[model samples]
Target: MLALYLLAGIAVCLYVYVLSLDGPESYYCRYDNQTHYNLARHFLDTSDWSALHTGSGAVADEAQTGYYPAAWHLLVALVASATGIDMPIVMNALNAMLSGVTYPLSSFVLMHALFPARRDALFFGAFTSVGFACLPWVLLLKGQLLANLLSFSLTPAAIALVIAYVHAGARRHWKGLALCSALSVGFFGVAHPNGLFTVLVFLAPFVIHRIADAITQSTWIGSRNPLRKPWVVWILGLAFAYLVWQAMLYAPPLQQVVLFNNTGNLNLSWAESAYAAAIISLYPEQPPQWALTLACAAGFVALVRQRRFWLGLPALYMLVVYGLCRCSDAPYTLRTFLAGFWYSDPYRVLCCAELFLIPIAALGLATIAAYAHRKIDRLSWKGSLALVAGVFALVNFFPFYQEPPEDQSSEVSGSHFVPTVGTAVGYMHYLMESGYDEGEEQVYSAEEQRFVRKVLEMIPGGALVINQPHDGSAFAYGLDGLNTYFRHIDTEGTTEQSRTIRDHLSDIATDSTVREAVRNSGAQYVLLLDQGLPYDEGRWLIQTGEDYEMGWEGLANLTDDTPGFETILADGDMRLYKITAEESAEDQ
Candidate 1:
């Protein structure tokens, strides 16, 4: 058992080492990352943590006043302040290490809490968790979702403490574990409310089983107060956790997100959602882990055959998650109502299922190893550990072991055709290719970031710059202390003046309405960017097409002799123009 633990620890460390390939400075940029980075910068600049606010655009904008979950932002701010290092480096390092270290250790802790005697299953399950690709790569790549990542990474540890409290069985053992469990649950809630929902879903089966066991024992003894059982301790612990969550919800920011955020709408039909859920949960990446999925099935069958029903709780949890994922859109069904609490997203629901599936997959692998050991004379426990370690190294780091490309310049983005998934090679490739090299999902390139700082120095503080969020000027507030017309991709709650400017800014020379809108929006400079990347062209147009189109036409219209505009800077794909027309149509 000790050797198994040591081997697992070694493998986990190696995984983190692999993730650190591009050093602490390199990060895959996304719009959300920019938004959160700006939030953290705001916190640092003001030293105010009362509520989340982005000091960009007009005061009436949602980006300026709307509330957001702030745990991830707060942590980044606190770390940067304490270390006095750059915020980007701190943000990237902490985000990576949190997922890299917490994930595997939390899986091991949860497996041990559930089955203390099954070392083989525990080892394989936790080992498998070290390679799980869905959350770290797919979900992270979606938006650089740091808050979601932090919440999910911590869920297993929180759930493990609750399970320990559930099985404590005595008054002396109860209070300490119960308090710990409550604190864990409290922390998980503030990290992300979706994670709190996940914890409750995962705990339902265990709580039910424990309550049933308490009832059966009470019946056998003919005891009174059967409701006053050991399971009630877990309930009290959860109640305290609830109190913690409720207290945080008292804050207006949390209230806005929890009570009135846009969530819970169904995106697919029942069967389609179920199929998508299964594919994302089990076969999340290319060359899907069919062997691991089959192993999970085999493990569940073995548990039922061996009459170890308690150990198969994760399978039941998966079933409940599947039902919720697929049935959330079915009108008149109970799930339709309950799905709101879980956010009604199949990806999130199935990600929770995938987390629980880790232990079952481990058990299946262990069962296979045991069978093979019996049949083959040479295989031993040491050999099993070695085999697991070898597999871990091969799948994660083997493909990217060769020499990197010759041109390691951060100015030009690189391209890789193969899937990076969760491998260390994948991590480096993502930073170099999609982010710095090609700017596919990236908001800004290395050169653009430098130019932004120089542009900030040129402009006065608090001056509003006309910008399209998709063109990367949305990052101005976070990366440098400059305001922009659109602070984020979402244009909800924007001022009427800003909206008019967005649609007709290019007609400022001839159109009276465009001139009036620009003057009213605080006549200032314009930040234009080259529409080169796939996203810049049209990939994410559903959300930012209007803004991109407006910016593209404005850039084309602003030549050297264009009326009411003077080009300030035209470096590569980025252009900064000074708005020369302060006179409105009425003034003219």
Candidate 2:
């Protein structure tokens, strides 16, 4: 069964990846993950263990280390460094590896915690994988999200530890269990900066329960009656105080690294919010929504009656939190903190709830299959599960077998995740052989390729290059150059570059002002998008993929003939401009 879990996990990951490879394109993910990949590449190249770039920069430098979560990238870099494997390959395996770890742990939790007599670990593993096979967030955003998925995967492990400790049946083991919980939480704190926050938030009910247990047994140090007495309140009071102290110590430093995009209020109806939460559907394009809704409902009801439901409480809590944020009339501070903490996007509630959803929905499948097992004579429950898994595989993925969606635009409007296999193969071959030039518009043209390489060739080592609306392209594949004047800055803007550049460059308030600002920032060259825009802008999954007017300004003014701009190269639709006073005066 353990071996089956391993194989099933790897097989499912490989199945999608191999299919993804069927249509070869320069980018594994059409839109996102470039920033994360480049960031990992930087860590590998620099051997620097401190600070990560929220956006690209020419003179990429580390800021306060503890403020930002670098542990996730560090793990990716370490594996790539040790094995000398490509980042793409590592990324390909990133979620899969974590998810693989997750399946077994989840199964163990389900088995020991829920269905020990079912002899169904294998079913649990396979069913769970298939149950989430069509997840939009996992598939649609693929490489874009690192910490969310990692933390979500760790959910099973965290819950498993808590459940195990509770059931450990030894008083002495409680100390070890406490230590384990601390270690688990500490790792989450490093893995995702807000990870411990999620764990603490989710584990509140359990914590209160444990307090009650201690009080009932007269073991609580301060509490004689945890339930009815004020002692429990005192315990909570101390916890809050400690949290406040930790926040003061940690938050300011994190402020140095984290930037929150303005996540405003979302006034969704209760039904709409609950529906989205039930489906865990952040990106509607990735999979059919009704499927998830149906499955999640089944699992929710099935788990509600079992001991495992308690285990899912944290996940359930996150879902409730998401619902609260969706309420327009919801308290400002509470919604703002929860919603803002989640990329300032309300739909990210789905991400926080992902781990919780996985086990719940999977158990829904097992519940149905168990019913079949008892009722059906010829087909075993495992067989029914396998059949169900096979059906889900086809239903979820069958859409992509047809023509792939063109670029990111089609991905949003259409019903599929990526372009057709044929599309990828042809594009890759064309770029490798000829490079994009003339009318051959694909994701990127070869001229821009040469232009970017030339920029790298000319720029001094460690020098920053500015690309407005910094698509992970320049840094993802560019010549040993990074740092951005405009574009692709991660939220929670804290870096010196992000703050400085964002003010002047965020909006091209004045072309001349931006030009002078670029020159003043010590930037020698800028990759101006004479033509080209991302398939999606400011738009991402939580909005159900909504495009917004671009936040990067000054593109309309980036004419080669404009002041402070000398055309170094014009490749395909993109133009490279040199930033110098002499050129600006000439252009003016």
Best TM-score among the predictions, by candidate number: 1
Q: What would the C-alpha RMSD of candidate 2 be, to one decimal place?
A: 8.2
As a TM-score, model 2 comes out at 0.66
Q: TM-scores, in order shown?
A: 0.75, 0.66
lDDT of 2 by residue, 372-396 (tens): 7778889875688876567644554
Q: Could you tell me which 10 consecutive residues in candidate 2 have the lowest summed lDDT?
A: 423-432
**In order, what lDDT does every prediction score?**
0.61, 0.52
**Candidate 1 local distance difference test against the native:** 0.61
Off by over 4 Å in 2: 15-18, 21-38, 51-66, 79-96, 99-117, 133-143, 206-267, 278-282, 285-309, 326-331, 337-344, 377-447, 454-526, 529-568, 576-588
Q: In candidate 1, what are the lDDT values of residues 344-408, reduced to their tens digit?
A: 44455556777877777777777877776777788897686567546644664444422334453
As a whole number from 0 to 100, the lDDT of residue 469 in candidate 2 is 42
- Clashing residue pairs in candidate 1 are 412-437, 413-437, 413-438, 414-437
- RMSD to truth, every model: 7.2, 8.2
Off by over 4 Å in 1: 1-31, 51-67, 219-285, 306-339, 388-443, 460-463, 503-523, 531-542, 546-559, 583-588
